[model samples]
Target: MNQFESLSRRAIQAPESGIVAVVNHGRLKAGLIPLWAGEGDEKTPDFIARPAAEALLAGETFYTWQRGIPELRQALADYHGRLFGRQLPLDAFCVTGSGMQAIKIAIEAVVNPGDEVIQITPAWPNFAAALGMSGGISVAAPLDYVEGSWSLDPDRLAAAITPKTRAIFFNSPSNPTGWTATPEDLTAVLELARKHGLWIIADEIYTRFFYAGGRAPSFMDIMDEDDRIIFVNTFSKNWSMTGWRVGWIVAPPSIIQVLENSVQYQTSGVPQFMQKGALAALEYGDAYLETQITKASAARDLFCDALTGTNRVVTQKPDGAFYAFFRIDGISDTKAAAIDIVDRVGVGLAPGTAFDKGGETFFRACFLRRLDHIEDAAGRLADYISSL
Candidate 1:
């Protein structure tokens, strides 16, 4: 057999990222207002970056605790206390290389080969892809899409759980769709998990980006001490530290060591200097994060309004995250349209095909950018939609 055919089926079957394909096509294009990626246009603030630089320069690069440094874990606890109004033990926190890694470790800790994970669709494709790589099947429990709003249906979610299902992967304030779960929704899902004795892998990375007065409703707001829930969060969105690759998990104290063991095998813990910076973000970056939320809120309104004004796009200002996921009136092939939008209008958008099922005809734009850029990109997109 050929070398390509000799590789494992799982490795060979992994799909190419549809978003990255569009990005690769237009990355070097001139004057492109790129919003295809799930990150803001801002750099990591000096307050957060400086500490890491200083720590690196001071030779803090040694291999450290797999469960994260004690100070950083304590800071994570304090940060959670401030946000969730709960005091969790330090053992409940295990730092991973990224939010993506946290999800993988959570999957590994619970799922065995041939098991299933029921995920809400249209999801950030990485979770399903990562789950597949770990020999887990991802069954879709698609959200109901009506009048440009996305919402969960608890009965549908429960129906997706089969005997082979080990967990439900939930991402609220979702990446591509900005579908934030309500308090009632949280309670419903939690009850289902309780009934099914299934684990809940909570991806609440965008909780702070909620535009509804305070943070988005979280599982922490409702879960009991012994609930079968694991929260995976990242420092990327809050502090514009996308490049830092730092994320943490909050699981039952019973599973912290097990998750840390996965960390030991995968990355052997995050860099010590980077943990120092993450510690700084947790301890001193609240004001900075608030400013970012404010900026995203403004950009969301401007961008969504502009697209809506076209009268040819179906979208609403998303309730939480920084994305504006919309469908153009005449565009059924979002992948082709994404390329055309990038090549013709110099605006980068992620096609919905990247976001898995139930998102095939939509497009996702990251609106956490400068107001002027948002305005410019919105105008260009509106014009393109009008032409379509």
Candidate 2:
């Protein structure tokens, strides 16, 4: 006789976020070094914030088009063109509240009830959640964690496709895993998507965090205007604007229309001032982004070397992103291990199971904090592993 009993079965069956569960368990404890989310400790730069403030001062805070203000959309198109060296047009770009919303909107627009989406794992849980919230099924095709790094097997992914599969979900410089898909991998996947007549939902949110270069190889670099690709990115990583909640998507004109309609029902558009801030980021964020990428590259080496000192834990320096995804020998219950480490060592990390299948015995720790904090967390984690 509970009032909440009227909720639908999907609502009842949806599991809690394992990352949030661990964070909640550790929140009350004092002196905990948290590295549970895909975020850094840096503040948003003055140049980006000033524009939004100036817009407010100039009294431009009314509602705009749900699709986004035309200037921001055009700015994003031009920025991507400059970044990727491809001529992206304004018709292909749409703005949303966040990258998560972009993924959700793209999923809902492309899929119907009972449709299956082929996703590469160990994926961010939201990828599967987006599919589920749209009444679609997710088929996980895991990447091979070979010799210390994660690699994609395109044939394995192609094999996962079935008559019910409507799309393929791809994340490069993947969250938690930090695997950047090769250009060859992209070509292979594109061929499969074409063969199966499937859509491609690409999460390139970590594009600016590449370790070796200005940006990671992207599907956008090679995608044609008519290709079945929906690319999603946010201002969070490059501009450190996670709290701003501004993300953009690139899709075909037909789906762009759907995204416009979806944006109306989603959040009725992001704030006009916030869109101004995003435009500023597109204009002036390059130098700051390069600095952050250099910092992350250094931190990756420091953290990975710390874990490599002991043979008990297996780890690889990530090619991109700010995560150290590693495995502990003989431990199958990663969630339990992660919670125990939090309780004992005063360090926090996300368990492998929280991501998707093939994550057992693995965990993800972000290294985007201050160097001292990263060193302290690294020492604590290494000490815990050595003691085990």
Candidate 3:
């Protein structure tokens, strides 16, 4: 058999790439103003890069600890403590190649073959793929859109759990939707997990970018030390460190060991210089991130205003994060609509169907571009919708 066909069936049947793949294929014309990706169009702050460069100059290129550099882990622990107002030890955290890898390792550590995993829908599309790759079945619990806001139906979510259900994957300051779960919602989900003895894998990558009150409720606030909760976050979004590939996992000591062993087997360790860069980011990159958040918030406002009163287009002003998820009237094929937007309007966006089955009419526009780019893209989108 050919190598392609000889691969595992599960690997072969994985879902196709959605919006990112479209952008990669040059669907959007060059210089047309693109904002489809989740990251901002900003470089890493000098405070972060200088230290990493220094480390490299000092010949800190070799692999260090399998878990991560001690100083970086300690910085993460301190940062977590400051954010949550609780002391989290350095031993409770493990560094991975990226936030994506952190999620993969967490799932691998907790899920066995055929175990059922519940995921909050309108989620990051890759979450389902990660679970499936770990041999887990994904059960999507979709959020209800009301008054331009997305909310989880706790009862529906609980009902979806079966004895085979081993975990629930949650993302907040969610992708595509830009909805931040309230404390009450988190508490309700935690209660359900506690009752069912299910694990919780909370993806908080966008936690630091919250536009509302500068903070969003987290599973860490409600979870007990012994609860089966794994918190995964990265320096990617907040610090403009997407290319740095430094993310972390916070879990119980047992799971930490599992992740350590997995890191050793899967990729050995994140680069030592990158770990140092992350440490510098955590210590001195706050002001730079704050400026980016302010710009994103302005872009969010401008884009939402531009799209308002357009026929058959409905959007919610995001409480946190920088995405504007909107539904197009009478448009059922989100993938086609997204491609059309790029091809005709020169504005790239992620298709709703990429996030979930229920998102067929929805599409996500990232607001992390420059203010001028946002204005230009908004004009193109307005013109396109008007013509339609």
Which residue segments of model 2 deviate by more than 4 Å?
Answer: none
Tell me the TM-score of each prediction against the true structure.
Answer: 0.99, 0.97, 0.97
Which candidate number has the best lDDT? 1
The deviation in Å at residue 369 for candidate 2 is 1.7
**Candidates ranked by lDDT, best first?**
1, 2, 3
| Per-residue lDDT over 1-388 for candidate 3, one digit per residue giving the tens place of the 0 to 100 score | 9999999988987877676676775553776676778889889888999999999999998878999988998998888887888798888999999998998898898899899999888888888888888788999898888767788899989989999999999888898788888999999999999999999999878887687766788988888888999988888899888888888999997678888998999889998988889999888776887788899889998999888767557777888888999877777887787777777878888877788756657888889978998999988888988888
Tens-place lDDT digits, model 1, residues 228-247: 99999898889999999999
Best-performing candidate as measured by TM-score: 1
What are the root-mean-square deviations of the candidates from the true structure over C-alphas?
Answer: 0.8, 1.3, 1.4
lDDT (Cα, tens digit) per residue for candidate 2, span 1-388: 5767888767776768879888988988888999888888898999999999999889988988788889998888788778888776688899999898899898988899999999989888988986887789999999998767888999899889989999999999898789998899999999899888999999988878888777889998777777899988788877889899999888887778888889889799999999999999988888888788887888888889988887777788888888999987767898898889999999988998898877766889888878888888889988898788
lDDT of 1 at 346: 96
Instruction: At residue 344, give the lDDT of candidate 2.
Output: 97
TM-score between model 2 and native: 0.97
**lDDT for position 193 in model 1:** 93
List the candidate 3 regions with Cα displacement exceeding 4 Å. none
